[model samples]
Target chain A: MAKITGQVQMLFDLNKCLGCQTCTSACKTAWTDKDQGQEYMYWNNVETVPGRGYPKGWQTMGGGFKACTNQVDLSAPLPSINRDYGAPWEYNYDEVLTTEGGDATVGMLVPAPRPDAPNDYSSNWDEDVGAGAHPDAYYFYLPRICNHCSKPACVAACPRKAVYKREEDGIVLIDQDRCRGYRYCIKGCPYKKIYWNPIVKKSQKCIFCYPRLENEDPENPLAKNFCVTQCVGRIRWVAYAEDTTSNLYKLVNVWRVGLRLHPEFGTEPNTFYIPPLSPRVTNGTAPRIPTDLLAEMFGDNCSQTFEQRKARVEEVFAILEQERAKVAAGGTSELVDILTSYSESDRIQL
Target chain B: MPLWPKDTLTTGRSPRVLFVWGANYLNQAKGFLDVYQTLWPKLDLIVDLNFRMDTTALYADVVLPATSWFEMWNLNTTDLHSYIIPFTPVIPPQFGSRSDWQIWQGLADALANTGVVFQDSLPDGTTITRDYATLGTDFRTLNTDGQDLSDDKDACQFLLDSSVETNGLTMDGIAEQPARLLETSEEWTSDLLPNQAYYGFQRMTEHLKPLHTLTGRQQFYIDHDWYLSDFREELPVYKPPVDADLYPLRWITPHGRWSIHSTYRDLKFQLRMQRGRPIVYLSPSEAQARGLLDNDPVEVLNDHGSLVAHLCVSPRLPAGMALMYHGWESYMLKNNLDDTSGFKNGWQGPCTIRIKPTQLVGGYAQLKFRLNYWGPTGNQKDTRVQVVKYAGTLP
Candidate 1:
């Protein structure tokens, strides 16, 4: 693995995410709308786990490092434009407007008929359809962007050597000028985040809003990434992973509550997720989500992760409960002060 | 005015001609298209004045375009917030469109040119001729020094200058800094939270002023004769949902976070974030019991009518209740293939569920007639419906 200095990392607490898609819309308006080819591209997407993500069935696709060799296998099936990434659909406003009405009848409005294509899926196709039955069903939103991994499979699989990670901030970016649309990086990426813009005939992926980060004054404390700052849920915390005083460092290194997605892939993903803690099921003490399914997503350490997360959550709840008692007695708690310091100006720091 | 106007249209006793201003009835009103069709030829001269080519404007005989929000000067205040926001024109009104105030002024001018007269009886049973031409002059003289108040800027200024709540505030001040709070009375001022202007009910409490109630106090017991004789609701009481037992599921239509009512529902990017059409959320078990899958076209039906939408089996939703976020345009609804004629009459299927009427008791004390009060409150959530897997495929 190549060593990097001052790497910026992000931690997303799943419990706080409401899945409102404010971050997704903000990223889209800032970067993607100008190009027609970029209509299907969403650099930041929030998908319900235990659901078929933006591009259908991304979890099943094989890539990343082989477990035994820890080497990138550039032989995975390339993401199909039709089957994986669905085309955007348009509505039929003109037809609905001109329709004549008669006694006891009203005009109708509906989406335009889809073109003759086998692929019908769109981004976030299985939204809100989490696994399990009623009264015990479970789901949590997983917002995905480029992981900017330490050992990027996309960087290794690129035959043209167009993909590279910045030495300064560890942001993995594709060189559009050098890219010849070989699509090797697309096949090598296990996350299936790289998109092939047919019109531009080049590979494209997330840049982590590097321009915004680059323009930030080093003296300023309120600077933040576009997605991290725009999140309506306030679930995202971003800072240099090495910065001991940062929230990211406190959560990942000190508290040890955050875990990377699919750590078994061995890319050492920089984006970490705080796994969801579900309510106890009525039938048993087990959580709402089946234990085996979570194990499949987060690797064999899922049980240990859950145990640690549960203990941490209980500790926080205990603090809150104690704080409530203190407030009732006309006093205050330092624990409450620590948790409630989430004003906009203090939410993100350089 | 009745929202549905079912009795007024069906009886055919009221005026035949209709003039609709800002409202998009074809999308907003229940059974409006049916009423329009039933009284088509008989009800002549349907005029619509709106900013966009909305459903109502498309069906009208005369469609007069009105200025869009960004192309007009207006003052806005919401019950939820303390800010008095100003909407100053960023660009001139597009071709053939005028502000609503300007349109009304023009109509008044035309009436004055035609020499119209007004006659009305006083409370003491005296009737006299009133020169209606003065109405046009009165509207034209709203601004200072006989300036043309028909202009939208002057009209907005007149509103700000005349109201005590906004007397100290000016359009220029708001233009420089939008969302400035109105300068209210001294008692209403908040020292701790000065920016928020925290005072909605200070007059009644601090000034010891009487409330607009029969007892002139915060009386819990309503002494209205109609409340006792008709509704029997002398005090606040909890009444169970009217049709909860009729169907298996209760339907809730709440305001969407994406739009205010239906205002920004048509924004392309906002629509892209959604399912691209109306969707109904059901609990996983409820969907499983009906052999339904996620994104399956489902028909939600009650006694009143049925509409088709994609089903989203949500774990967050509790059993025995279905949620459909409101403000989707009528045209964005999926058509039901079961309807043989394909007439599109049931576009608002989810909203077609039977609405239970609130007690019609009124005309006494606090129950007396007033704008936005003492009338039949539409029971939007008092609906029950069953969902069936729709046979047709969704685009």
Candidate 2:
């Protein structure tokens, strides 16, 4: 048994995932298409994971300098972190030009860094786009989003206390009313998920369909997370991974069902994944000899798994045999069924 | 006006004229100096390059504080993309920044004092790119000229208003028809083309016909059949320098929202975003071997010079490679701090050193002091080794 912290998490098997981007499109159709929600980003993105980050290089852009938790300055890796502070800037490129020879070159213009790096760096920064390309170059799309961390750095980093981790589901949320756009939370989050709505100057993030959760009670067919509901690969599992003995917990924590991008930072992130690491199984049109270790971690049915895995280019079709069986069986003897049964009764705070 | 001797060029057998350069790539754009020095026989040429100096304009014995983009209004017509984009700013620049046009205007005046006057007018022309003569019905009332390169603020306003065009779109009324054309083989408006593009940098034109304005008429030919090269036959011709140590690290700092390289380094908000020093990006596999962490302060030294930066450890880089971002400076108007106190932490500005424009430093700005995230580049990365032999199947 575990404490009902009201913290819930979702996990996806990256090994089983195909990067169809259905999840992204689904969210766009459900939320971002709306006026107020246009700028509000969501709970997930399918990054290349190892190489190119989603929505460009969100990582190298740097947000906060999370101070180490240890009293002494650490040469070795430490557990927690502190936010790094730096100045922000705005620009206008047309402030210094006059027309000549029917051509007007820009003046006083310092534009922001462009989308791609110099030397024509692509999202797949490593792969060459033109001439003598690698024949067997491989990359698997890794969908990523806010991890709904157990000890969210964003909540602790907000000096104004504008952010709160819901006691019910443990979901991190921003109080738009109280937020003054200090961006401390933005700095504190190692993930850099939190963003300032340039229009309203408040903080916002994925609500996990809170309105739908309360109204339709989650059990209702209409209730769905725009990102999770639309995954074609069916790899997205929107479960309350609280119970320890269940397969969900085992897969996420022990078998490490999902791996973290990095753990040394120690944000206690909730998102977990079965990585799309294709280190082995190199060469040949098809891998005749499956990497034994990879097959074992995933299962003996490597043929079926790889066959289905290969079809993961479009994420809208995720319902493989394993997932179909789980959904059809109608609630396993897992902790989730027990917890949700009591969900209505307790005034739970995450 | 600053005073100087008229015989400054003939003071010695040959006087060294240090030419300050930004990223012009064109060595002959300033060939006028070579012509002048040959006639006068008094100039010894030495070109000093400041890779990304937005603050100072280095000319042939001429010094100008180039006005930044925010300091001037701009109108531009892309000969390649074929459309005019008007760039306007919300706020005036903070201090001594001046536009390139103004600097050239001054150079023209200076040359005039040397008993030379350049013609201030050029021949009129038209491009078959859009058949500019037949662009609109009345030229004033009808506006759809079929182009996608305009960044006019009125474009956003047009999206909101109810103006109709000959094609029944408001954008056309403002002479801003999108350049999207049907593909040669596929259904014209398919997602195939859209898939190749990024968020804002979408290509509007489908068929890249050789623009006619510069040539006086539209020239149609297969993609391969064009006599297109200023210095060579290739479009992006890579001309390696004869002197290897002259320039290395084909540095490229694409755009970001914080602002272009040197434009925003002065303001309090943006100053925090820039790197205090020029940061050279290295792959993680390269760093691990050299004993550097993702944020560990390390020096990226080449034969030309060295730049210090926090390591950005990511798997994206294959190996035997590094990168650096360009543009940032104090502009001399902002509060200046001595670099002695904050050496390890790094200083924020346009270059590695805060020397006056007259004296150049071999570096770029930091943008900001923030932690950049990269994926676990490899199980064990070795960044320093020059030869990046992939150690085979690393995590």
Candidate 3:
């Protein structure tokens, strides 16, 4: 079942996790910061899986679910995102004005590093917080981000030809210079990994460390992608997602595909999950569930389960359903025309 | 001092920091150490202030309630150029919530209340400075040429020809302000510094130095190597703690993106990510092998305290590790945490433990109450909610 791109996925066993957020913090520190991060972000979210996911309505809200189909419409204008998704382009014109007698000087130079307070306090201040609540309680974190599907919805929804999926490894990327910030891709993507940057005013998401991925050192370039490498609990992993000779991906799809994350949403997200074994299910001997689900779940890029990708104009198409602008006044059904269904390979174009 | 936090507080010899860092800010923590090392303090005994309630607090002498980021004066303009914005009260100090400055202010007022006045001004007086208004209220009304603009805009203004002091300002010609942090290296070259007050302090500590202390200007550092006897022959010498077993888990509890410590716990929007049950996270495989569940409730136990949460199984974490976002409360539960709940206190102070026994809105259990009393307990199993969204980065 290996995909054409030879891409594989991974699954994490929550029971083994100690909730030591080394992976989450390491990622934020290593990659999610810097000017590129801020507005359009969350390359990693260590969400409590027992609740609603990190992104509010990503699964059922976007385009609803659909079975895979091959024909995708390339020329249709892509969908739009939530109105306030970007922001008010406030002008930081502080420099444009000057104080009369008091010159418009920088006035002060703050320290790059603040002085070490004798006592630096924070919220989680206990020596052993979150301990001893249940006789046999289990609380584990699930790190989430862009799955970079073998067939990326973002690549299909771009009107500006701004997004592309890398051929070598199916990592989806946005060319900032080419992106007009139409926000169409953001809405179309079920994963919602793409983000609109207010500073640069462009879309951004995880790059899968392409530069590091192509390096000759043999070790994953993002060997230190913050999370995988620096986890104090040793619960993380880093490997070539393409090669299935590894046990990571094979275990995911083959051993445990029944436990899926919002599968009804049709993005074909690459990140897979070995559903948490609840106390009820595991009251019996939990199957010696293979430790490696990474390759099995997503290792196959050409999964036939994903071939039928572009049958559009379904009712779940939020923006196209006039969900973007409250359609009070009468206007041509821009939706019916743009997303008008056709049997051509591009099928329902929108 | 052990770079890695010691299981027990390090004392009698050198400084040891039990840095309770947030996974959301690993770089910020590392960046902090790189700078904090420059100004090592005299004595050390530590208990970090991460959000989770399980870290050891037995060693802490005074459990002072502290201010959150938004609660304080967070004045920032440009990169390094900015003025201090006075801290404004947000929600009437979440029951017993107190600012770090107020803690000192309260201590100062208490000390004064006892008639034992200390030579130093209140410790947190510098939370923000009225450095400008210090000259006098007339500074705001004064005209360009030093005329009282209250009377007439075209009035003939006059510079004070003689030395005159009213309140803190003087009639001695206008003082020139420093252009930036470090305009001249010579100013930082010597120990003797300016006598005038800048911000709130009169002395020239690193805070008052020119901004470019990055070039070895006004930075502070201390060498604790002399106090170490357990050093190995490692080149970049570091002494791993001998008592790592006392607290095996390198404790970390991060704040919610917008939750100010214990605040915003039971609020509907905030609880969306977590399905109403306190959860600790682990890999699914571990949960399976150990009879754990995708969303099974469990107790997080350590020497200091314990918390109850739902299980989150995913590959996002490493083995033998777990994490719980801080600011959970018993009040978040539809049913209050009871003795039968088998839960223990994970954290206290910071208005977190400020609670009253009130009936839960939905259920028949009674729990401790507070402004926003959050704890680690509940029956949230098999739940997932979406919490964030974006404009147009994805297709």
Top model number, TM-score:
1
Model 2 reproduces what portion of true contacts?
Answer: 0.04
Which sequence of candidate numbers ranks them by lDDT, best first?
A: 1, 2, 3
By summed lDDT, which 10 consecutive residues of candidate 2 chain A come out lowest?
A: A78-87
Q: Candidate 2's residue-wise lDDT over B193-272, tens digit each?
A: 44343222122243443332234234232122222322333233444433332332333333333344454444422332
lDDT of each model, Cα atoms only? 0.70, 0.41, 0.39
Question: In candidate 1, which residue pairs clash?
Answer: A109-B331
Error of 2 at B387 (Å): 11
TM-score of chain A of 1: 0.84
- Model 2 scores a TM of 0.34
Q: Candidates ranked by DockQ, best first?
A: 1, 2, 3
**Candidate 1: tens digits of C-alpha lDDT, residues B360-384:** 5455555555566466655556677
In terms of lDDT, the poorest run of 10 residues in model 3 chain A is A118-127
lDDT of 1 by residue, A1-350 (tens): 25677687877877678888888888888888888678888889888888888777877687788872558877767878767777666665655554355322244454333422344566766666677766777888889998898878899889888999888889999999999999988888888888889899998988988988888766754655778878888888777767787766766665555767776666778887766667789879877866555555653222345555445545434444577588779887543343344565544655
Off by over 4 Å in 3: A1-8, A18-20, A36-40, A70-140, A216-224, A233-242, A253-260, A281-350, B1-395
The RMSD of every model to the true structure, in order and in angstroms, is: 5.2, 17.7, 24.0
Tell me how far the alpha carbon of residue B274 in candidate 3 is from the true structure, in angstroms, after superposition. 11
